[model samples]
Target: MRGSSGVAATFWSFLSISSSVLALEQQPFQFEAMSVPTYTLPPLPYAYDALEPHISAQIMELHHGKHHQTYITNLNAALKSQAEAVHAADITTQVALQQGIKFNAGGHINHSLFWQNLAPASSVDAKSSAAPKLLKQIQATWGDEAKFKEAFNAALLGIQGSGWGWLIKVETGKEQRLAIVTTKDQDPVVGKGEVPIFGVDMWEHAYYLQYLNGKAAYVQNIWNVINWKTAEERFLGTRADAFKVLKASI
Candidate 1:
């Protein structure tokens, strides 16, 4: 419904999917992108209908191309506008650009993670290994996996409007625990530096046709396609970064 042009959408989708990873020759911690991170619509890791029966091809195409690309376009525009306003010292324009930057960038970051977090159910190789780690963390925090899922689902369904239901690892505490958190309308999870290891998108565009109005079914089914290796890498990466400050002193 957003960038609905077929040519533009196809071009972006292809470019994103086929684009090779940018090699970073720089040192560690150099890529701390918070305010002006040049966000791009990451290409889906598989075919548009790769996860069919769970997510439809038509829906996937529209969601990735139209919806996701619009956010990236708007975010880049906001960044350029912000730079100009800062140079010209235009307070009014500067104030207006702030909201757009955060909203659009948040949308980009959120969807980037969302795409990587999924795959065809048949493609998952480490589900058994990574699932129990998440479960143990969940149960330790919530007392049981069922209760953890219920709370997680409640957080998802309780979104009055559009937002995200996140299972964030609160690394600040002594033990690793999964916290059910909600954010309103494309809010950034790491703007203040708290890392988000997992997120469940509650937006209608995320799960409308497949499960219809069955939010619970959709939430339950999301576990099937999770790329646990990627998730574990993200978890260890974040923890390694955060605890680095502590480890340095010790």
Candidate 2:
């Protein structure tokens, strides 16, 4: 299996190429070589105060601007430092940078996705609230939506310390299933080959400003801002991609 640093390098390389292509395409006739792309903190889809009572503006600012930016910065530094070692096939240097790369890359990936996972309660339409397809899958897997929420919350509450609670889609042979899993620190769910359709950060920094020590309250209230529409889109898109891959393989 590829180590964390390898994964981080591959992910950033793809991002770099895509960005370079877009930059070149935007220009009329200027020919300029694209430099290596540095990972950046993606802007939140909504305003800082959008989540409001459920997630305070102060928390959003600190979480997105400060915390997430730190990860992006560190990730870029780690990748840059290890680039030559990685190209030289030096496993020792790669291993030494693995943890830092994983932590920062995972933080960047998770926080980027987390921002999209939320929306103002009012802005979420009835269709988003319904999540008909996801609801059926939830019902089939966990009996009902309420039961799924209960189980998911229980999983979040069970975290011994800083971690994340993720609702992921996994494929087993011909069958696709939904699973609730947790990852410690900033580790991402995608590392396990599962697509994270929804995730809630269980770290204190995510809620300490507003809920204090009440992790349960934070977890419960986060449901109010969850973008079910985004979750459904991820779920269905992953499934569709997997199907296309399977067909191509055949």
The models' CA-based lDDT, in order, is 0.67, 0.78
TM-score of each: 0.74, 0.81
Best by TM-score: 2
Residues 10-70 of candidate 2: C-alpha lDDT, one tens digit per residue: 4655575576568757863442332334776677888999999999999999999999899
- Top of the candidates by lDDT: 2
Q: What is the lDDT of residue 150 in candidate 1?
A: 81
Residue lDDT tens for model 1, 1-250: 1123434544554465343233222322453332343555666888899867677788789888988899988988898788668656799999988889889878877777777667787874437366545556666778986787688778888898889977676655444445678998899577333656667788888888777788778777776766665555455445333222212221
Give the 10-residue window scoring lowest on summed lDDT in candidate 2.
241-250
State, as a TM-score between 0 and 1, how close model 2 is to the true structure.
Answer: 0.81
Per-residue error (Å), model 2, residue 225? 0.4
| Candidate 1: worst-modelled 10 consecutive residues by lDDT | 241-250
* Model 2, C-alpha of 66: deviation from truth (Å): 0.4
